[model samples]
Target: MSKLVGSLQGYIWRGYLMAGKNTNKLLSGQATISSKSYAYSAKEIYYSTLPYAATYHKSAVTGYDPTKTKPETSYGAISRSVISNYQPSMTKAQIQTVIAFEQAKKSVPDFRIVDVPYQASDGTEMVPVVQVFSAPYRDLDDYDHDGKWTTEATVRNVLLAQENGSGKIFESNPEAQQVELVGPQYAFPDDDAAMLSSNYYGIDNTTRIIKRVGQFVMLSSRLKSGIFYAKASDLITLNTNKPTVIDGIPYVTSMPLAPASPNHYVDTASGKALKAAGYTKVRTLFDDSMNEYRLKNGVWTDSLFASFETKIFSPDFDYRHVYFNVSDTDEGKIKSNKVITLNEGNNDFKKLLMAPTETLLGK
Candidate 1:
């Protein structure tokens, strides 16, 4: 019988397709639910603001009289006015662009701009004007042709030069020779020893020595107290009173334990080592039986011998052919052994089966 020949199998196949549809619906529904929640929250905020606005206006107009029954504007009318005036004027795309711009501004601190309201050329209505500051510069003389600096370094240098009387003055026209240095007015002592002898003049010898000693100590500690080399065999404790035994293996005092090298039996050269250790591909039943031992369950147990069907024949025979002139039968048998029995109503199994096929088919 064919593996796909069953009503239950057909149902399972169709169930996989249905599961994909359900998954798409679920994902789309999640977006809808989020949008609905946001709308509900906005509605709640809009309604909540009405009472506060009503109270504030009533208190301001009527001086918060306790005996007053009603305000000049009804609460319902205030709510309606708020709802009409406070309706979102910006489109979704515009809102998203604003959000993105705000996020970008936060991430990149150099980007700064402000919206200034200005009257139009017609002088009828006010329009928003985007005023952008000069981009930050990293060095002096890094300004554009318009003389707008684009880096922080340029701005800092200009400020420092201005304070030090070395900056150029640009009033109507540029002025030259703006900075000038004069000769020092104070005199210096001729004797270096007399200058050193003055206690308040400079650091004393004792303080210098203390500073040097502290620096040396810090450097030595950071360098792990100077490097020292030793052989691996010499890394052993010489304590005879307390013996070190790990995992039932006793280590001799003052004697180094060399780590065993990993066995690389996969390499051709290393396979010879396995051969030297008496490991072979073929072994008789008696040779195998010799390795079996009686377990705690009072039963002798040996290594399991697993047989698989294969077309190839070799000296290393892990597989055995049981059927003669029946390759199709062998294939069928192998496929039957590997059959995955999924439940009819299992959505997970359906998704697993359909997702990959759909992805491959570009569905």
Candidate 2:
């Protein structure tokens, strides 16, 4: 069972959804309203499906028409009517770009202007990992020679300036350029309840101190990582030669992980445990109380707060970006102990967190 990126949220889940592996089996066998009978107003589906703005239709001109009877209701019917949204599953190369940017900015503070939900060329308006600079926030000041916190610019300029991929991919193919430009931006919500803040800066809704530097470039991919990111100078080193042939194929030079720190995070104990289980490039996230480990050999290996509330770094194994996941919460609260196994480069594998804890079991 090969793993593939999940179509809905863009996280790497187990098995290939296209191949129809564990999808149905993973389901609760629930049914939705649209799955049942007549067509509901697109408006209803819009609000119910996306949570935000209301989607309305033009009112009928004059008189009323049909007097049809309303149908039965259930959690199954209404909720299931959800329109599954596909998000950007960036390649290993793309993921590294975000990581490099974040790594570059180690001192800059976090900043937010506005949230503008957008639709990609793919017709999906998934959460952007980064937003705000899409249109220049003319009011904000533009500063340079600092860490990742970029100065304000119009939204459009931000998008263009923040593009990824070698120009080669775009030089010959305009269609491909459109696709890359519109990929998902991983948006990290400052406040789930407060929604959006116009002038709110440096403070969480409940007044908790929110870390300005986002470890992972998620929710929206359009917002490029700032200079304060980890990659700073060590991310990708430029090579000078174009090899005539490798295994028969000519080699082209490009940026690759520069192998910055010798400090690979791993618990010799956890390392021994997982290695005994056949894991490679496996490392741990730890502190005073918890010790969590994730395998880097897989396609998508993020330290998801949906599992643990702590932070972790996720880079593509083919050695692309280094997306860090740094959380402000306590280590014990994180869904620490788990195993993510894979079969191929950065986009294929299984995420299995068998024991959801960070402590050692006496057994």
Best by TM-score: 2
lDDT of 1 by residue, 238-319 (tens): 1232223322322222211111343211213222332344333211111001111111122112211211122234454211
Model 1: CA > 4 A from native: 1-96, 101-114, 129-363
Q: Give residue 219's error in model 2 in angstroms.
A: 16
In candidate 1, clashing pairs total 7
Query: Native-vs-model 2 lDDT?
Result: 0.22
Candidate 1 TM-score to native: 0.13
Residue-level error in angstroms, candidate 1, position 213: 80
Candidate lDDT (C-alpha), each: 0.19, 0.22
The TM-scores, one per candidate, come to 0.13, 0.16
